[model samples]
Target: MNFDLPLADISTDIWDTKYRYRDGDVIRDASLEDTWQRVARALAAVEAGQEGVWAARFHEVLANFRFLPGGRIQAGAGTRHRTTLFNCFVMGTIEDSLDGIFSALKEGALTMQAGGGVGYDFSTLRPRGARADASDTIASGPVSFMHIWDSMCATLISTGARRGAMMATLRCDHPDILEFVEAKRDPAVLRHFNLSVLVSDAFMVALDQDADWPLSFPPGRTVGNVRARALWERIMRANYDSAEPGVIFIDRVNRLNNLGYEETISATNPCGEIPLPPYGACDLGSINLTRFVRAPFTPDATLDLDGIAATASVAVRMLDNVYELAHFPVPRQREVARRSRRLGLGITGLGDALAMLGLRYGSDASLDAACAAMAAICHAAYRASAELARERGPFPAYRAESYLAGEFVRGLPEDIRTAIAAHGIRNSHLTAIAPAGTISLLANNISSGLEPIYAYRYQRNVRRPDGGLTEYAVEDYAWRLYRSLHGDAPLPPGFVSATEIPPDQHLQMQAALQAHVDNSISKTINVPADMAFSGFETIYRNAYALGLKGCTTYRPGAGRGQVMTADQQPPAKPCCELPGAD
Candidate 1:
């Protein structure tokens, strides 16, 4: 890979403003190379011996943006920022009481203060108008409490703290779910939260049967019932109109979870890439696929499978080192991270790589290429973790028999599985596909994880120190690279934008990759504004049928159109915002 390549203007700006470490008018990272070196040094310090050897290897993987770590890791690692290396956490379950709620809120505040996004499952709270057993007071319900959290996040952002990103999930069976589904209808409410409904297998069955579904609480308290199909339509309509709340197939998420036997998951990190149990946390990184492409815009184009495998191996080790170097916001979060040692390693530049290889984004050939690339990364990461376990010890929570029996593990290559059985794996779950928005931008505006190019060129608003927006022109990395090579030439058929691809193709791309991902994925199925309601609903139905853990979609000129329009401009947040992201 060419490490001497110059960064695009936007990439340079992103690095200088968001990632470069500085102290009291002194810049710690004088250049992009310095930033990579700083992070490499910090992570490699965790190695027992060969710190110098590992630092060089880590730096090599990071150079030329071949591997992009999560924004939190890029900014906080080797810095005096007093922040977490982990990007996000599923906070401990809300306790369903005033004290419990406030305590959880404070924990969230602290975690955010430490530069981590938070997720919460609000299903435990009683329904609105329900009387508390102990105090006999009318409960304000979960949505009401979410307002407090929303305000808190806004307050943090106001103070120039890390950009506030949060996910709030409510169970479909919750009596107050109706209100939760409509919470974002006003467009001005809960601006800080990304909401999702926890759809259970039972709920899908009810919808399939067109039967009445009970809205109930714990201990068999039946609040009321509604027509299942009607409720399902409401959810689809809410998303069709407002672009949220997304749907999480909660049953599938838990059942397919590698650690399902040990924990129950109710919420996901801000973008839904990782569905974590209470107090669960994970760090993230991506393999830039464009770096592995052997040829460009020619019949000889091919992916360097071996190179991808090698990078993935090094990336796993680097992320594992983060566990030793990071500071967790809470004791319980640290405990969970140490026990699981979860890492999210995915791919970026997928769209560009596909186009560079002369393949369409959603075609069968592209799907095959995607599966091949993801498989190499996934298997390589597992093998590396197993080797690390042999060198050090496995994660404290690893149980050889149960872990191997997991649905995802059972499908791994026989050799990888055999290795895990012999030497326990260092990480419970190794692969997840994040939105990778900010880091992808920092990597010269490469295509994000498993997503097509959002646009070839668009205006991006960068927030200034004075709280104003500065508009800058941004171009897709592959487009610029191609233009530089073949000036004024028309793009190949493979070059397509997010909206240019069919909605089913977007879902298909995600589904194809999901088979290899042990953790959930964060992908937005982009639908044209003219797409029919029935067609829109099929995307979710198909996602469930395809066995995806969750689904999020974005429709231009939808209810959020007031904020996100159809002029090809990216969303104020294209995906999950990274810590310190604009």
Candidate 2:
């Protein structure tokens, strides 16, 4: 399988040599030309299918940045500016209190209508019996407030196009923990929200030792007297059945968080990967990890490391420019953006990567290859960032060797050193790993963010704008493998599920690669609801044990949140008048 690879015309040759890439080295291409065409084809499919809303948002979504400092801004008509996502933390609350529960409803209605995602750590609102200091009136707690917010989302269509993405996070110790645990089961509860329960490292350890875990909230409340193992049991039970609530390792998110000391992060953006401060919309983009291929995969399966580093140089350039290409909204985004022009350069098609090299997705051989590939990419990305610092000058925070050291004076690339001494580089932090939601959906139907195939092929029925609907069958790599092997064959039973894969396997896969990432990894564990909640304690331990920044898990009925399922419909939006009229 080995063949000669030309050093010249490398960008083009690398991908062309993919056929020859050995089992140890392979990357999905990051070239704009091919990716652009693929994006166009997707848009065309949506348009041809008369998916106006989806099509309309295409340009916007591509330009949208969901990392921090610069978030969202309006797109000028005459010219296109790189766009960023600006999320409002507490959109409809605080401003209106005791009596005006409906005050913030309109904000939610309108924002979600514009296709903007919203999230808030409802735990701040006083619990069921607590009083609002401002109005002297009793409060109904976070869950009641969620009902109003959910109703708004139900009423408004995102940008009158796609559905809005929202998140509601609650502290595990909240007195209403029991109620939040099973809120989603009603099928009549929050219909437009995704829920996650925040857990701490202290609590996780209790579960393992069979110690009493508190079900108490109110910072000073008595820690409930139940065995930690028992509480974990309830959590695992819910995950097995409904996949309602997800668990968030709050303490983990804060540890080593570059910005952890600056602010407390309670919620994550739409896809439980990128954690953000309330009202913080982060600007984000990715470098196609496939660009590092240096040579052909000979029958022997060797990889080229030098070429990977050089192309990583090009990727750093593209991501750095993304800051300038994008238009940021609000002063905070612009300010923070100035401090660290951050970007997430994550990978995709990992399974495809392993498959191309003839490696199994779950085996030890593939795991080793995956980890090595990640290290190479990480080293290259950092080196490239340093190179840019030399020429244009380092990021404001770019230190010599210390992460927080800001002055960029010594030990820079020769070419960049002069440029840095001349015209400082435009961005700060240059890397992150995002889940790659739409991008993954459009390209090859690969499992994203290190996720295995949930189902070989599952039908996703989307409610269209006209009140009608369309169904999409997402096919996984395994199913495609079966189809290609026997185009018309259908004789097997007991097929493998991503779930069929072992638990530790998932952790090992995420951990092996996470070490090399600057920000964090956005992978989720799919535990069956029937499985015990107690199982989660181990999953949490393994992540920290593995040295990951953070981890999230899906369990049924984990919190009090709203979501759109077949059975429940969105609530009608409220109609109110001008300032004083009503």
Candidate 3:
């Protein structure tokens, strides 16, 4: 008998369909009987691994993990483990190397050590000047000081035992913009951070008007270039060439910020998907992106509705349960979670999803389908989570009249709403699309977010449990789909890499897919180390043109003094043995 389990389940390597979530069915469609069955199957697998790291591996930072109806999750159990890498609040950091400029690497490190990924404004550190973000008489410039924190991140891992991830944001008004743009020109900066320049709405207006724009940092930094368009050109060139120093429209960044009422968001979690609070960690989880795409398009190939619904329903349950298994460090974090029951049920293997359905990510049809698909996922996740709330109670902040209120509350069944008013919810916000890292791996190498493959078969270098380097060959699922479209041999697209594909499609593809996701996506636009820095503007505008919540990219020069490449990177890595190491 084939005794298989979920991808991460060690019991069997085979794909376990027993607990499979059927797509195309909404919470309304899924009978409670059908929902409960899925829940039981998954929890059984999880309970089976309770004794070892398997349980811990799935544990999140702050929320407790519990299976909801249809195998969904209910966060805020033991630890309040939340989702990471999904779109959340703006996460900002004040590096304190400057003469009291910000919290030196110490506080930032402390925050990350406690389970937070950070975002930094290197522009404030001063352009490689005598004073960094601080007023200290003599100090290094922003870029130099960034290295300090980078080193700390490299040296001091997080409480989860994972290397801290961060985003460095420099405004367009800063001097040394060129230097900042080229900081990751080398593969050096890839170690501890993701980098993006904060562009303003003015910059886009200027680009459109063909006018010159000023670049300043704290009123003291100088504008290093003329012909704003020229600079934009250079940036785009760099993006196309190097793909680093991704651009973040500071104006838009604030435009979407709902918490600006309570707090200003400046930075984001590691992957730049979720902007977070100071010392904030993104508590993320996701569904399989491919699961939503049902194909065999009517003559032209549209999405398959049934498959999408089934996947969405099941994904909701799986992510809801994730909260129960997570382990967080502080009570403050738990309280943060109680306010909102947000779960990032994003898709992984979009490349695979699209591939399975025979669609190109950059194409119009695929893009349109993507939007509908995401909208559907968002819709499905919220509905299921609301149903979960019916039994589990609505998240604490679920005031039907409030701004933080979930969109689902109004659409929920009246009976469920009544249950919520009486019982309250088990989670707060239930739909966010995170960078399904481990989930993607376990799901069999799907393209991340709306991204295509990065390489076809590059040797991924990774650290092992034994402190040794291990190389895992990556299988680009996109390539498989590309090949499958032409043939029907009986095998799914194996794996394809992005390196061999057209680089221009990268940004366009992201812009196209990001339209439907309410939360931001975590995708690193890759450029070769030698790529030029002139093409960044076009890329930046795409986000604007596309109205993305936010965007980030990795350039060769941006990752200076960092780890740039992947080596069989695990879901999370080995950490310093804590008080108790099994």
Candidate 4:
């Protein structure tokens, strides 16, 4: 069967370079149809006598860019490569001892070598200048050891393997927290790690009251103290000068976790979407919202809610099947994965989808539309998982009482909750909005994840299989589609790029979706370089107030490099050093 081919050059480039199946010199995926069929057949093989029936369903969802699996699944499924199907993993904690640190480092290396990104909570390490009780030796803090891991990641990437993405998280109260926050000030240091402050509720309250906050470690050992507001100001100033350490509401993450009863989430998979316990991995896929928009750019524009629901259901099954077929890098990862089958089923092309509906993103009307669409997808996904549980079985970690008591679950529709109580649920957690940057490009450069369009047109640099960079002229999906329809007509007011949206509205959009998302959403609140430092700090404060799980922002001239430049901006040579980027 002939499926619609990729409409843009970048779409074809991403597929061929990132997702296409190849056996050395031989290309197995001759076309995108072959790629989709290959993945569908592989995943459906685990369906127990319903392979043909389910394969067709999977293919239909995957075709036409309607649903996109994580890059690992698309590239490794049904192939001979011994790589994981999951995109990322939160590695087991880094033990403070020498042996412990190296063991965790080895695990990260293996995981990355097998084509999966990794996240690590470095708060376990002792503070710099702290004397070890047993060894009577001075200890280097988490930030110091991070350099070792950074070197390891750089070495792996230099070896011509897949690009490495990692997230390193430090508790806001850790004695070395200040150093961790400042470690990335130099562009050349820790290039492979995306750092985040694991901000607890206590710290926020302390900041509110202008209290002196103790920097404690090793359980109740106060190594130092600083004014809470002062520390926060330092964080904000660091980010304002150089967009390094993003903020994560760590306490809220655990509180809202569907598996909170069984696990403590201190770190997230790279890109801050899947907050995972040690050894936990995320099986991710995204339903393309653009494909579900009906009569786009017309007075009758509306999201095809039924279509999204159907596609989301099938996407869950496909992600669940990934567990059966995946080649986990470590046995512990596989063990944790089987116990709690986590699926990050989210949406891509949201910006374009909103624009297609003639609703400006971050507007009140757009928030309602986004909420309604996410609600449909979220509930539909839950219902699908429950049905799978009855057909197969609940995930090993599922405890009906504890699961039902979760904040996110208790808020679900009664019928869906009832379904879960009666028949269990296959996946422990079901929704996470990822930075689908690369996959969105594969889908004709639709606005990525929940972000507004970065620009109507830009030059995107894509890395070739041989490690060289190739630049492509890319245009927004909605922009191109609208041009096709109206022949260079003036864009409506609904079309707004990322820079044009206010930081608060960006937070609002994320907060609106976070209501339905169990796993966190990966959104970068783009702010202008000239924004006041005080105003910059308020964005993080607002994120906490608005109950967002985390927040990241990018300024044009920030320390971090860019992958693309708008037509009006100065040209930028593409850089792949971004860790949180998809």
Most accurate candidate by TM-score: 4
lDDT of 1 by residue, 1-582 (tens): 232235778788779887999975889898899999999999999887788999999999999888998888899889988889998699998897899999999999999888888999999999899999889899989999999999999888788777778999999989998999989887777888899999999999999999999999972688899999999999999999988799999999999999987999999999898889899999999999999888688779899999999999999999999998899989999998888999999898899899888899899999999999999999999999999999898999999899988999999999999889988999999999988877888898888888898778877666544445556677888888777777899998889888889988988989999998999788889899999999999999999998889999989766553211234544564332223221
Per-residue lDDT of model 3, residues 122-190, tens digit only: 665555554532344655567776777777886764323344666787777777677777776665454
Best by lDDT: 4
How high is each candidate's TM-score? 0.96, 0.68, 0.66, 0.98
Give one clash count per candidate, in the order shown: 1, 49, 129, 0
How do the candidates rank by lDDT, highest first?
4, 1, 2, 3
lDDT values for all models: 0.87, 0.51, 0.50, 0.90
When summed lDDT is taken over every stretch of 10 residues in candidate 3, the lowest stretch is 62-71
Give the Å error, residue 191, model 4: 1.0
Once model 3 is optimally superposed onto the true structure by TM-score, how far is the C-alpha of residue 71 displaced, in angstroms? 18
Candidate 3 residue runs with Cα over 4 Å from true position:
1-104, 110-116, 122-136, 157-161, 175-179, 210-227, 230-234, 237-241, 258-261, 289-307, 310-341, 385-433, 453-458, 473-508, 524-537, 550-582
Q: Provide the lowest-lDDT 10-residue window in model 1.
A: 573-582
Better of 2 and 4 by TM-score: 4
User: What ranking emerges by TM-score with the best candidate at the front?
Assistant: 4, 1, 2, 3
